[model samples]
Target: MKKKLLNQPTFLLGTIITSIMLLMTFIGFFYTPYDPTQMDNSNKLAGCSLEHIMGCDNFGRDIFSRVLQGMGNTFLIAVATVTIGVVCGILLGAFTGYFGGWIDEVIMRIIDVIFAFPSILLALVFVSIFGTGKYNVVFALGIAFIPSFARIVRSEFIKYKDMDYVKSARLAGVSDLRIMFVHILPNTMTVLLSSIMIGFNNAVLSEAGMSYLGIGVQPPDASLGSMLSEAQSYLFSAPNYAIFPGVMIILLVLGFSLMADGLKSR
Candidate 1:
């Protein structure tokens, strides 16, 4: 059954695309065809050639190298944001759901308030206050994402907290923490995993949007969003500047979406 599900076209394609991007990100840590940050005005806006496969940006930085480096930056921010959201969100949600009292009401109300604002707007506010940087972007996006993850985890915990195994664990004199973390949490893994993938996809997109708006990773650090923002003016003359990064962002998001769908199907 597992093998059959893995063989499904959506799952296979997602895995392949995600693996390629992951490989690119890993390789980018050690090497790129040229220095991604180095500028060469003499070769600025050059088209694809044997020397520079993805061509050059207006600043003459190798687009291929920049894209490779940007992959690492983008993935790093997404992973960090998702990690923060999952850890903090799950703990808060599980406690609220399992306890279910004034505590739950208070927490849910706070979450509701957060949800009242669109995520991008919240992110913009955070960036504006905290100032623009890579870590700031991660922090902003992670905080903005907390409400959704918390809601999902809270629902999952509510469903599983009353299950037989959980009750048995409680009757066995197990601590509430133990029941929540050990007994209840494992049962929620399917939903949690699905939420995690979706959160990661959203994180990536949010970071890109923030960066494009000039509130994300700043200059000299290549990010897919910043790359697109920079290439906008050069759209007509150096279309590859916009094209490569734009395609990369699409592929990244598509890979995660397909993976989430595949997992949910199982």
Candidate 2:
């Protein structure tokens, strides 16, 4: 399995990219060349120099520092969003699928209604209603993700629950919870992992979009989306301002997407 995974170019490349991004994020939480928020009036929009690896923004803040910080924020939000979605999704899907009946019908109906709208759109509405901030974005996107995760887990559960091995386990007095989680869940990891990668990618883009609309991360804090939003006005004056964040977003999304592709290929 290890050798096969390593043999995949998509997995190798995606692993490299995401590993680098993760390293940058981990480092950004500790050290940076300049305060991401620090502004130097005379140094505003300065071109890249040894002292400012990526140059300075309109506010004279180090674009490198802000870029690092933006990556951190985006990653943090994605992690939080996936955490919520996975926990809730797994539970809901496990229960509904293992014990099917009116309860399954009711829950599935509710899921259908939620699925009618895009997760980000649902998140957008939630952010609009709850007011904008990082946690709010996490919450909105997290809940919006539940339906998809649940559906995936549910399908897997339904398929695995009736297998001869499951019947033997049931006859042997294994708890339903154990059967669902211990025996069946691991089998679903192949598909679930791919979905997780896609979910992380979606979270990044959704957060970026919400922040671009100026309703997501807010000022003083740097986020890729918010940085992209801030960079828009300076496109002509400082094209690199937009370019840097745009590139990071692309890399981030691409890394996860490629990772998903690789996982699916396996």
Candidate 3:
């Protein structure tokens, strides 16, 4: 498997990008060139130099440091939201697909309603009700993500639930749980894994959108979206401020997208 992945250029590139971003985020936990939030009026708006690698923000904080922190925060939120979607979605989809009765009808109807709405729009609604915070963003996006995951998982399960191996297991007196999870779920991993990468991409974008709107992560905290939002006013004076974070977001989305494509193709 590792050898196969090495031969896939798309997968190799995606893995490299994702791995670098994760490593940078991890490093932010223990070290940074400067305090990400520290204000230095004297150094504010200064261009990149030996002292400040990416230069100073309007408040004179280290842009590079904040970026590292922002990367970590954005990644954490994405993971949390995706995890919620995956766990809930798998359970709902698996059971409904395997059983296929009145319960499937009712649950699927609800998922359909959610699926009809735009994920960002539904997330906006939940954020409004729950109020603004990292956790709230996670909750809103997580809920919004459930429908897509459930729909995918359900289709996969329905397709495989009655396969020959599943029937053999059933005849062996295997419990329904074992049949679904042990026998069938493994068969769905390739598709599920591909979807998971796509899900992470969506989560990253959604969180950035929320933060850009001033309702996510909040001020004094660094998020790529919030940073871009805050830097808009200085577009001419400090174009790099926006450019740096914008690039990070692009790299992030591109990395996951490539990964998903690679997984699907492989």
Which candidate leads the pack in TM-score?
3
Global CA lDDT of candidate 2, please?
0.91
Please estimate how well model 1 matches the true structure, expressed as its whole-model Cα lDDT.
Answer: 0.89
Q: Provide the lDDT at 128 for model 2.
A: 77
Q: Mind giving the per-residue lDDT tens digits that candidate 2 earns over 1-266?
A: 97888689999999999899889989999999899999999888888789987888999999999999999998999999998999999999999999999999999999889989987788778977999899999999898889999999999999999999999999999998999999889999999999999999988998898888887788999999999999888888888888898899999999889989999988
The residue-by-residue lDDT of candidate 1 on 167-247, one tens digit each, is 888999999998989888888888888789888888888888888988888889899999999999999999998999999
lDDT (tens digit, per residue) of candidate 3 on 1-266: 97897679998899889888888889987898888999999988888889987888999999999999898889999999999999999999999999999999999999999989998788789888989899999998898999999998999999998889899999999999999899988898999999999999999998889899988898798999899999999999988899888999999988888888888898
- What are the clashing pairs of model 3? none
Minimum summed lDDT over a 10-residue window in model 2 is located at 119-128
Total clashing residue pairs per candidate? 0, 0, 0
lDDT of each: 0.89, 0.91, 0.91
Which parts of model 2 are misplaced by more than 4 Å?
none
TM-score of each: 0.97, 0.97, 0.98
